[model samples]
Target: MKYVLGHKNPDTDSIISAIAMADFLGDGYMPARSGDLNKESLFVLNEFGIESPELPELNEVEGFVLVDHNQEAQMFDGLDKSKIEMIVDHHNLGGLALLSPIFIRIEPTGCTATIIYKLYKEAAREIPENIKKLLLASILSDTLNFSSPTGTEADKMVANEIARETSIKIDEFAAKMFKAKSDLTGMPISRVVSADYKEFEMGKFNVGIGVFETVDPAPALERKGEIVEAVRELQQEAGVDYIFFAVVDIVVDMAYLIMPTDKEKEVATAIFKGDLEDDVLKIPGVVSRKKQMVPSLQKYLENV
Candidate 1:
């Protein structure tokens, strides 16, 4: 049996894409997750009456069909590149030296689910209501209900089609989704930091970046002291040049950069045009980390 899985520390797009892809492929292709689901992903699954994907036991699978992410570092830890039978992602193409021709689709879209919807159209396959819910939820999660700069018209159109078919109010549904995502009340500092985190190869530096997108930043801010200490320990554990954790207020379009130390704060102050009030760097109009922050970071940190 073939297993479709997403990157580690699976976000909504990653989790839903895996489930949707496996369904699109019909029988024999089973959905799987690289890690546990977060509050929002679990909310969506329960809302749609869909079961969460199980963790793929490597030896029990034939090969992988990765969704949402293409980078090897983000992939299952022991997964071999050669075992990647197919890939459907919206991220930049990574270094994959496959000896054989493998199926791959990488698009510059706001969400991987958007591309998957296109695939369904091309194949003349009908999308089920559950699959449609998964796609719509994934798009909304990634694009932050179209509030994110990474969102495009394509994503909006696809989401609209799903919403209309399901008779779901976009704004109302999005409000509920965002509310579910923002409820990170009891999660530990470590899990909160790593929940939506990923490592990237940025200008020779292996940077580990994490973001906790919330509607109300007050709850996370309450744990600010513990978060700083957690980030410090996580940086040491990740062994990256830097571990940057940002608490992004989606509703306010603002970010509170958690600088673990003076050195991180200084470097962040240099990189971002933001105010460093204590260990937290307050950045305005910097919501989408992928589109807004990554490019500038790559340019500025090229030499360093």
Candidate 2:
């Protein structure tokens, strides 16, 4: 049997793409997750009534297909040792190198689901209504409802097509989905910070960034001290050189970054050139970590 999975710390796109692809492949293919589901992913699955994929026991599988991410760091442990049968992803290739030739489909589209939709078209296979809903939700979540800089026209077109098939109003469903993911009212500060966390190795620094997108950033910002402390604890526990926690206001397209240390604060000020207020820096029109934050921080880390 062939196993399909997404990156560790699986987000909505990763989780949904894996499930959709496995369903499309049929026969021997089985869907799986590399890590625990985040709050947003859980919300999406629950909203759609999709069962979460089983977590794989071994890090190395004989035959496997990866989706949503291509980096070894973001994959399960021992992926490099596994026989990679195929890769369908959207992110820039990182340190995943395979010795043997494999079927690879990496695209510049915003979401892997967009690429998968094209594959279904190429195969002349009809997408089921449930799969269409999953694809649409993944695209909306990854592209931040077409507002993210990483989003492309391809993503929008595919989303419209899926919406038409699924009979889901894009605006209404997206608003409901985003609102469901944003209600962090009673969540602990640690869970709030780790909700959508991702780690990157930049130069000599092990950098960790956590993003929390909401309709309003006030509720999270209201607990600034506790959140900052949680970030500090995460930094220490993870042994990361720098940690950044951002509370993004999806409605206003603004972000408030929380930097726990003086070094992190300095880096944020240097990169954003925004004034720090109470250890939080206000950055307007900064929504995407992949398109905006990661590239800028990687360049800064490389030079400094």
Candidate 3:
């Protein structure tokens, strides 16, 4: 079977969408994850008695289906173009060129699973109970339980319908999922800094950004020195000139941004204009990195 996977540093939405798409495509497609699962994804899979997709070695895989992301930067490095048979994403085009005429579906939805849900409806196929729960989980995650700016009416509508059908309370389940996401008890500083990292091509610069969202910020905030070092190492490893990791407070609408070195701090301050407090920038009312941070940074860089 060919593997269907999402971008690297897979979030709950990325991983869940892969599972849903694989099921939607029927036999010959198995859901896969490009990176290790974060706490939230693990909790959802375990909660629903779903086994994690077997990690496929990219070089050995015959062909693959792309879901949740289409950017080459977000995928395996030096990928063979002919290996891609399909592409489905919710983000902007990233100049992905394929050899053959492949199936491509890109939408401006909150989550790729939201698109997958619509696909089911359009095909007149009844979504299974497990897929419904998984889709609801993914939509809630990517939309921050309908609080994120990325959350659209369709996302909220789909989530509500599944919540009612599966008899799952949205608020309660979201709280539990966020709680599980925040329990980064024993993770190393490196993993904490890169839980949800994504690289964006901003003008002439490749900027790597990671957001760690949690109900309580203490777990990440308490490790400032280590986070600093980790960010430095991670940026170097990613071969990016800039890397910013944000410890987002999900309860309140705030985020504490961390950038390595004085140079990075200066660049970030100029870009975000946030208040620097105790080596971390206090970005008030900024939680969704995709909606609030990346587009702004990309625009700024485009003009520079």
Candidate 4:
């Protein structure tokens, strides 16, 4: 049987899309998440009586599919590329789409579930009611209920159709789901980060970090100083490469990417067509790292 799985740091959209793909492929496939599913996603899966399959060791797997995210740097430790049969995702391409023997499906939609829903229709597969509900919920959660800059007309349309089929009121369900996700009082900064981190290879640099701004960049900025200090203290952390953090403002379509690299700053200045201001790039129309930043950055790296 062929299996499809998501990257580490699985989100609602990734989890739900994997489930939907499993349903679409039926007997020939199973769906999995690479890491421990987030609480939000876990709630959805359990609530719907769906259990996401465990991520199989990549060496033992003969066939695989990719969904939601497509970054080799963020894939599970043992997932070998030779086994993948397809890559279906909504995130901006990161060179993995060109890998041989993998049928690539990428669309610039708000959530990957939106794309998966289309596949469901194209394959003439009937999505279960609860699965449809989860898909709609995933879109709402990932797109910040259509407030994110990445949200598209198609996203809203699919979400509406899915909501109707699932019999869930969009506004009320979105409100409840968003509320459940926004409670992050006692969690450590590291966990909050690992819950949404992405790693990328930029030219000769191996950069990895998370992006989000809850209170203010000021808190994260202060913490960055401490984190840098700690990194200096312990020079042998496993995943410690060039770390770049971003304070993303969805409303402004800009993010202050905080990093301690001259090369990254130089590249950002070139991409923005202007000099960076105090290590901050005023990137207009940039929102999600998956959707906005990574593609351009990857192209920039390829050129360099």
Which model scores highest in TM-score?
1
Off by over 4 Å in 3: none
The digit string of per-residue lDDT tens for model 3 on 43-62 reads: 99999989988677766777
Backbone clashes counted, model 4: 0
Model 2 collision count: 0
Candidate 4 residue-wise lDDT, 109-198, digit = tens = 888888888988897878778878888888887887776767899999998888777678888876666444544556665565566666
| Cα RMSD (angstroms) for every candidate in the order listed | 1.2, 1.7, 1.4, 3.9
| lDDT of candidate model 4 versus the reference | 0.69
- lDDT by residue (tens digit), candidate 1, 206-260: 8788899999999899999999888888889989887789999999899999978
Candidate 3: deviation at residue 78, Å? 5.5
| Segments in model 4 whose C-alpha atoms lie over 4 Å from true places | 46-49, 58-60, 97-102, 213-241, 249-256, 260-286, 299-304
Mind giving the per-residue lDDT tens digits that candidate 2 earns over 94-119?
A: 76767888888999999999999999
Give the number of colliding residue pairs in candidate 1: 0
Scored against the true structure, residue 52 in model 2 reaches a CA lDDT of: 90
Who is ahead in TM-score, 2 or 3? 3
- What TM-score goes with each of the models? 0.97, 0.94, 0.96, 0.79
lDDT of 2 at 121: 93
The whole-model lDDT of each prediction reads 0.88, 0.86, 0.87, 0.69
Q: Which residue ranges in model 2 land beyond 4 Å of their true spot?
A: 78-80
